[model samples]
Target: MARPENVKFGVLGKNIGYSLSPKIHKAVFEVLGIQAEYDLINFSKTDLSKADIDEIKHQYKGFNVTIPFKEKIMPFLDEVTEDAWKIGAVNTVRVETKGLVGYNTDYIGFRVSLERAFDWPIESAIVLGTGGAAKMAVAVLKDLKVRTIFTVTREKGGILGTQTLSYERLEALCPRTDLLINATPIGSVQYKDQMPISEALLKKQKGVFDMVYVPEKTKLLQLAETLNIPRINGFNMLLIQAVAAESIWLERELDVMALVEAIGPKCK
Candidate 1:
């Protein structure tokens, strides 16, 4: 019942002209009859100074952090939630009158979406990439008691708590891996046909989850489908996280399904 002036939000990222976050958030605001404006703040690495971050906190009621800056922006935040601190990445920020607080809704999003897709518990997973998204996925998997999770990265060394596997080792690791998640941008719009692992490896997995949802059925998911593997796209995670972010901003639980319906048609 509050007026629209009470709510303002946006997403932060670079070269995110293709992102559906603004539309999704705006639709949620509309469906909830909340006065909110969701926009995008495109900032490159060099543009993310303390002053710049402070300005964003002052300008928007809250903002969602995205690619390339999720981890880097941590230091500029006034405080971070336990999950975000544990994951060492933040995807959502709450700009309160006191200060800015960061949180990782991605963890909640990933776990909720995966549980919906699979009734059974997820024991082990092979997470591809070592970026912020990968960190959040690993944190969620660990929370779910999936200690056997492995990390596959292009470069070696300095990655804590994960057995880095080279591309050559992928085939051997595929069968043992209960869940295969693509946290890299390999299947993103720009990298369409490209995937972190090969089709053969993907076919051997029990399930496939991609963090990139722009191309809804990413090549990774398509390959999984061909092999009859259970797959979940990034859209579900995006929606769940967006809902969580909205809750943080509004200080109330919004209708997640309504928001989903509003943004469903716009998602690719």
Candidate 2:
């Protein structure tokens, strides 16, 4: 199919006005000389239904899923790629002639971002939280041959492969953890000052990565900086994922470096 003149795409989530996806994608289209419009669709939890799914499928070219919808939207998809199935989440969806297919570009994004941040191979990592983002991180870590141990909250103990970690356990794990990842929204804008691990734990880590990108340098990264530990923000992951999503939508490979150069100033 030829590219449509009026291409429409969006990022869907609840309270998604804080997202930078639209800006990032719009800039990419503009730089590539493609006529496309990118926007955000904010839907409450109850608003997600078969009707809503059909409406999006009928109207849009593709859309990026986030937050509470990543997992919830899975049931609505006609087919899901292997990675998305393994991760148990869908962050990118396409409206194909056959049906809507779900794919997880988040895993690719996270892996590339982590590798770019640190040239050395990751041997072991402590992933905080067990949400959709954490699942994607786990998939990426597994692909990269990194040993990952999940740290869950005390209340949600015994969450399968996860180990319940109290403040004391975090203190012990921090020193041995080569990569500390905050997959929870603890350091997000609404939940500022809320960190999954204690400051003492961060003090001993070698590197830290946060999936929250709104405030480029999250509290976790700030603490890592103070401790002289190498830290990476989530924007790089977001950028790389956007590229993968665009490739899925356009059915062509894009120059990632060119797209990054076009959106570098804006992403910051």
RMSD per candidate (Å) reads 2.4, 2.2
Question: lDDT per prediction?
Answer: 0.81, 0.81
Candidate 2 backbone collisions, by pair:
none
In candidate 1, the residue pairs with backbone N, CA or C atoms under 3 Å apart (3 or more residues apart, or in different chains) clash, namely 4-35
User: What is candidate 1's lDDT per residue for 41-150, written digit by digit as tens?
Assistant: 97645447888887888789889998888988898888998878988899999887678899999988888888888766678788888888999888878778886777
lDDT of 1: 0.81
- Per-residue lDDT for 130-240 in model 2, tens only? 767877887777778775565655445433444547556666655566888888777887677677778877776678889899787777888888788998989988998
Question: TM-scores of the models, in the given order?
Answer: 0.90, 0.91
Give the lDDT of residue 209 in candidate 1.
85
Estimate the TM-score for candidate 2. 0.91
TM-score, cand. 1 vs. native? 0.90
